[model samples]
Target chain A: MVNPLEIKVERNKHKKTKPPQDQLGFGVHFTDHMFVMDYAQEKGWYHPRIVPYQPIVLDPAAKVFHYGQTIFEGLKAYRTGDGRTLLFRPQKNIERMNRSNERLSVPQLDEALFLSALQQLIAADQDWIPSGAGTSLYIRPFVIATQPALGVSPSEHYQFIIIMSPVGAYYPEGINPVKIFVEAEYVRAVIGGVGEAKTAGNYAAGLKAQEAAKELGYSQVLWLDGVHRTYIEEVGSMNVFFKINGTVLTPALNGSILDGITRSSMIQLLKHLDIPIEERMISIEELYEAGRNGTLEEAFGTGTAAVISPIGELSWKGEKLVIQDGQTGELSKKLYDTLTGIQKGSLADPFGWMVEVSETPSGVL
Target chain B: MVNPLEIKVERNKHKKTKPPQDQLGFGVHFTDHMFVMDYAQEKGWYHPRIVPYQPIVLDPAAKVFHYGQTIFEGLKAYRTGDGRTLLFRPQKNIERMNRSNERLSVPQLDEALFLSALQQLIAADQDWIPSGAGTSLYIRPFVIATQPALGVSPSEHYQFIIIMSPVGAYYPEGINPVKIFVEAEYVRAVIGGVGEAKTAGNYAAGLKAQEAAKELGYSQVLWLDGVHRTYIEEVGSMNVFFKINGTVLTPALNGSILDGITRSSMIQLLKHLDIPIEERMISIEELYEAGRNGTLEEAFGTGTAAVISPIGELSWKGEKLVIQDGQTGELSKKLYDTLTGIQKGSLADPFGWMVEVSETPSGVL
Candidate 1:
């Protein structure tokens, strides 16, 4: 039998009213529609649907519930200054998801098919996109193993889904700087591990350290090399960037750090701007000493969610090295402003990052 | 309002008969009934029941599908020669489950209630237990995050489940030693990581290496320390033990090595037998040198499923080291025989290790 995806439309019948502006936070309120597709070995991907966001019933013995064969990507759909909804390099998320699937040993889907499905779901839920400053519909596209088994190997069946939640400004007040603890005792990823993949285990492994850091009054935990535990890595969920003596410096994408899409874009943007940006292994001691000598200008983390989150203090083992008085640095703000400007359609899209995908590409609108 | 476990049972009207004694392999067949319970924030741990063993239905966005918020335990029940079932130290599994619950931030179930639930299910489907030599029904009790969301944190709700599968001897064809590849380039767990917990992420992280080793004609991978990458940590899914210079040594229970229930029981048995034993960090180079100089006589891995598994050779970095010429060593056989005898009710109950919970405890035929 020739099988294909049966694209179904199940609109929400009992959608709740939008939450008040003040109560809206990150990932708390989801949109009415969510995109979903299922995969089996013989049938491949089938039953692509945009259905009402509802409770998903699953077997208690599903493999993803037992073995963590799951991966996810985070991006956002922007409401342009002229009120047009656009996507920012959504193909990057698709590519990352495929890479992550390869690492997790899940099935790979056509990137174009995934993008089209995402467009359909977002269009159906466009009104849910917040339009204010630094606000957008945070899109989460993910894949998981749905087979019911207790084995350690890959699952035979899978599910790919796209869920959207309207998010407010990352920082409620304004763009703010926070301190991150340089975790020496705990390591996030190691060589030959799933450090580069956007898989679930990586985040789950970092939860305890994140909780401990929050208890210590820090916002995030900056991971170091698993071996030796000295070299700098990413900060919690985002890639780290540093500005030393008018040059953009970040840790090179080693086997143990995530090759973040935002980090790559920022590097490309810096290169285009004719900045001397170096991707090399920068140690914690070197950064701290540079900060002491008044040479470390700024440090920030780059990701699709927060864009560019400024780091003001590096709290090492009992040593507090303030990069810049617990405040957002000038370079951090400039990068954030340029990035958000392009995303929000206030500035020119020099890099061709934004793609208008609402109606039928360019013709239907 | 009074609370009762709300179960929607879907019975399996047809089930294949249990295979003959010779064909039964580990984790290959299941019983008729399985135990399940669900937990939510407002309704904590509801819906406990014994349902037919079948594939589970799941939500596409369940938190375990994306965050690896899952943990599990391995246990077994044996049918004694006089026709009574016995479970060896199930309390240990319960305690470990509680510890795992704390680490993953999942809720804990009362030990008494949990045991009663499992016993009820087992009693309901007790015919699946096999009475042949080294054959028993393996019990897998696990907890998973059943919440549906897209962000990373502790899951608000979870599910606790128990599934059983009948299995024959791990080494039914006589205990022959197996070769393993020593993995220095990869690290399974690091300091302050979730190595002590029997979490899915740990097993998931080891899959690629295990697959590579199996493809290279080895049975499993010998994991090393995440830091330094030289110290021996564990065998995949088992605890490593080395018989060096007539003294038994296993890797110390650092935060990165799981505290295997069988490993502990074997050590206690060895101590009772007046054999020398120590739990400390053992380096790979040291083991190689000892093997070369004839100081290392035997090596083995211990776990719940395979009570004791002997290792005969190790392939590392293009060097194939012949450990014991693929022969099951004397210590390995001795330890295995003792443990199996105790578990199967063939040996005397020394140190009060085995808690025989048959159909009627302390009753005669």
Candidate 2:
């Protein structure tokens, strides 16, 4: 194993002008530098460095282009009011990324090395972290197969990379509930497939269903389990939760549903708040029944991008079910405020979910 | 739609020495030139051309690396003793690729334009087609999302490319039967997923199971349907067929299984030979029962890479059932000889499966 502290750095000569804070959209503008490491079957991972952010060159026959052996993780770095940079639950994202690597048959990355790369890369480009009220630096860590072979077997070469983009809040106009269409035609993933992994193909599989929903004026598609086609799986790319009667219910960690970091955090936060929550299989029919009986108090999706995307309406089988009269629920508001407040360092991090970046210069090891 | 004949060509300045015919392996060495086209949401497909085989430059945030919005097709061009290049069922492959594009939410290519690109690319690099026995040029046509964005949606930009590699026989020592392991713990695909499409994620999802089967001294894994673990779906990357009581049985066109061209051709060839063939679901238990009853005659897989890969032994649930005494059956050998004969132009093409590339210079439009 390579030493995590022995990292090399190559500063970008020409720095890019940062975009205006008000115009910072999600994943549009990127920082000036990135972290990269190469993996070979015989040499393992080597040449870990932070270099200029630029286009990557790859052979057209790279296994990633054909076999899709790739995985990714998403997190954010918040710029505190005291000029400190903080990352929330980064270890959870790193652990989940390794699990995704195992599922995709890619080599496992050393957790220390992975964490060091993120810390150094963020430290090198700390000024790119937007200090706006609802803005931060969105971090994307990904791995791709780079072997220039067309075989179906696992690749012998890989590249791990981390890129950061400054972004505004998901809901720039304040958090409003979204209309979701319950998908019945296309499936995202099955229990035996790669749904649980943060892999590329799972997202690709949902594009068609999401597009169809979008054409019908729905913001997202609520995916159902591939086998039964009735059990709830996910909402677009997020883990879904619902408030039924007085208890919160989210789908259990079945092999097909993603173990979302935000979903876990929400569960912990609800428990800490003395609210009842259940993790079990939930069918769409049962959810609709709760809606008919006025027991479906609120519904929302949890992920890194949106954090807590409240669901205002759900359309399934030509029927529309509006939750909380097509408005955000009180509980969703409370959870969103508390979560964002902790993330931005405006409130106490009672769960100790934040990790502050070291201020030491990260240019040399 | 772009005109099929308006393709430009840029020849390579320095040509590398070709590998010896005996050392040629599958998809390891590429030809001198490759076909390329760009697709945009507003302008459609444009700038179709053939250029020197080289690495592709892509932004670090290209969607293909993150969302897996990609599709591909595999076919081969055989060089006849008369010095003519023959492509087997190219139209079918192009059609299937479009279906995959639809499933992955990618823009569809014009069939005529796709065929023209293939024909031109082959014509430009016709010298790369090996004329030795059991040697041909493997053609890989693929499309990848190229939009430099990190969102979980279909990409607005795409790149279509075709690369060629000269390859020798899949089994250099003649047609030897392979041992297959029946995978019980992992599933390949379920209906309502992207299984029917030739996308990257489906292949990535199977790598873990395939690697495990490899460690067990098996050549490939016999995949079961994701929903029902008992019904057989596919073997490795190919469609499987079994002969029992003098009748050939293969799985029907389930949505989770690929519609293989070689499988279709084999079905047609069997009917032409006055042999009975049935397309229906066959369970592993049923196949094992036939093995015990002395009715299992031959088993084989069909695909572009290995036209006919005969199965000698099957291991499942800690039980091994040897077929035809772990040797290639008589029918398997006959089918391989006939199909290869037709492909290489040594025999009559009864079904008109070969499409001969026109003898025209493809350097300029």
Candidate 3:
């Protein structure tokens, strides 16, 4: 467990100058410090500390490199207008990460310790938090198998690390709607697989289709269920949503689709706003039929990085469907504003999703 | 590409003492030297060299750690009776690795460069080769995305590393047949996924089912197709085959089953022997019916590690099916002898598969 009093902080002797706020792109630049904890089968988890951000040296035979025994969580820290920082529903991310660990056979992490560790690391790198509009410090917490062996079983040793990167808008075009390609030739996951968990393998297995979609001038690929290849599962790395005839619908968690925190929050927000929403299987054919009948009102992808990414167009099997006249939909805009407002402390905390930095022990440092 | 005269080798300053030959297990022990090369989008692949086996230093945000953008090939260097070392179908492994690279969006390595690299590495650690019966030096050549960024796309930088480990018999019980649990609840791969590719994610997605099978007292799991969960896919990490009524049947490469080098070689050998074999979809139901009627004469799994692993028993959905009275079939023994005989260079090299070490620059080195 992370004890704010017990966490050893090793300050960097030579600190790197922060990149220009506007130039920050995704996970390209890292903050000064990182939080790390080690896990062994016999000793469990030990040695929680904050140290200078540096490359990790691992044996060539580490299982993480060979078997892809790794899991990760991604969230962002928003700098409010009043100079306060906030994290939106970070406990959900930690809970999902533990589920991922269970599927990957990694040890379960204590949720309170995990949250405290993130707060400590954020405290150590508070200067890196960007205050620019649509800019925030992206936090990536991951666990990797470090046992120096080539066997395919679960590793005996593991390392849990949290790294921070100041990132701008997820899409370079800001909140604009983007074109998507419906992938039918490849599958990201199947039922009874590790797709529900935030493991590295799902992304690795998806690179080929993603690259192809990018080359075809599409922003991302809309993946279908592996078994049926008919029902929509996700869009790129985000959970997808569609507004058909004034009803919001997203895919159900059918063992292969990731249970994204952003997607859940959006569902809750939609319900709060008195909008009808349902989590069910939405097939491409049905969506296209709705498009033909002028009932496909809005579509978007929800994730931690993008919050809400509107889908302007979808091309499936050589057929193209323009969504909302290739523009950002009204609901997508409202959801994004409401969510970001809560995250940045600009609105009243109705649902109480945001956890302010001052509420944690960051002030103690 | 592998000009023996052009290769540079660095010997380890502190050589590791060899473990007992018979006690050598799987990938726990490493040789002194390893093959390494680097690739950048601008520089292609450069700096091919043999260095002392050591840990690889990488930024915490390297794509391989976060997205599992890694591909690997596994083969062995076998010491012949004439005191020469050989690699069985080494080029096949390279070709398969290239296919895996394409699927994982990793850069493809030149086959010539890959072969030369292996020979150079084996040359540097020739002394570590074990001479005991059934002992061979296992070589694992893998490529990983090394770009220090977390954004999920093709990596701009990569590393190709080859490490060797001396291993004894794959099964401690010799060639005895083992029980296999038919996995109906979990699917290893689907038709439109990275199942055929030799990537880390495929293996990582399979650990849970494998662990559960082991706990059920089974040697490995017999995977079914992801869509139907009826057609047989593979057995653990190996390709499976069955002999029914003097005819051999194996699941076709239907874009899901791995094109195992050993499986291909066995097919070629069976064709040469005028044996009838079919590479088509074979369902567990059909096999079970044959087992009940006593027409399923032999069942075996093939891979680089275990050339012919007999399946003595199969438990599908709690229905037990025993074959050959829980004994190794006659054909299983014959195929094992023939494959191992070809690999060790004690038998005829009719297929021209074995690449002798002396044929390359190893003798000069």
Best by TM-score, which number? 2
Candidate 2 residues B1-365, lDDT tens each? 88876888898888878999988988889999999999999999999989999998999999999999999999999999898889999999999999999999999999998998999899888889999987899999999999998877899999999999999876544578988999998887888888899999999999998998889988889999888788999987899999999999999988999999999999999999999999999999999999999999999999999899899999998999999998989999999999999999999999999999876734443
DockQ of each: 0.48, 0.87, 0.85
Candidate 1 regions with alpha-carbon error over 4 angstroms: A1-22, A42-49, A171-174, A360-365, B1-25, B37-59, B169-174, B358-365
Better of 1 and 3 by TM-score: 3
Clashes of 3: 0
- lDDT string for model 1 (A88-112, tens) is 9988888988887877678888876
Compared with the true structure, the alpha-carbon lDDT of candidate 1 equals 0.80
lDDT of 3 by residue, B71-92 (tens): 9999999988888988889999
How would you encode candidate 1's per-residue C-alpha lDDT over B88-170 as one tens digit per residue? Answer: 78889999989987877788877876776666666666788899887888888988776666556778888788888888866
Q: What digit string (tens of lDDT, one per residue) describes model 2 on residues A171-259?
A: 54458999999998888888778899999999999999889998998889999998889999898768999999999999999998999
User: After superposing candidate 3, which stretches have Cα over 4 Å from the reference?
Assistant: A1-5, A359-364, B1-6, B359-364
Give me the candidate number with maximum lDDT: 2
Checking candidate 1 for backbone clashes, the offending pairs are: A57-B58, A58-B57, A58-B58, A59-B56, A59-B57, A59-B58
Q: In candidate 2, residue B38 scores what lDDT?
A: 98
Kindly indicate the candidate among 2 and 3 with the higher TM-score. Answer: 2
In order, candidate lDDTs are 0.80, 0.92, 0.90
Which sequence of candidate numbers ranks them by DockQ, best first?
2, 3, 1
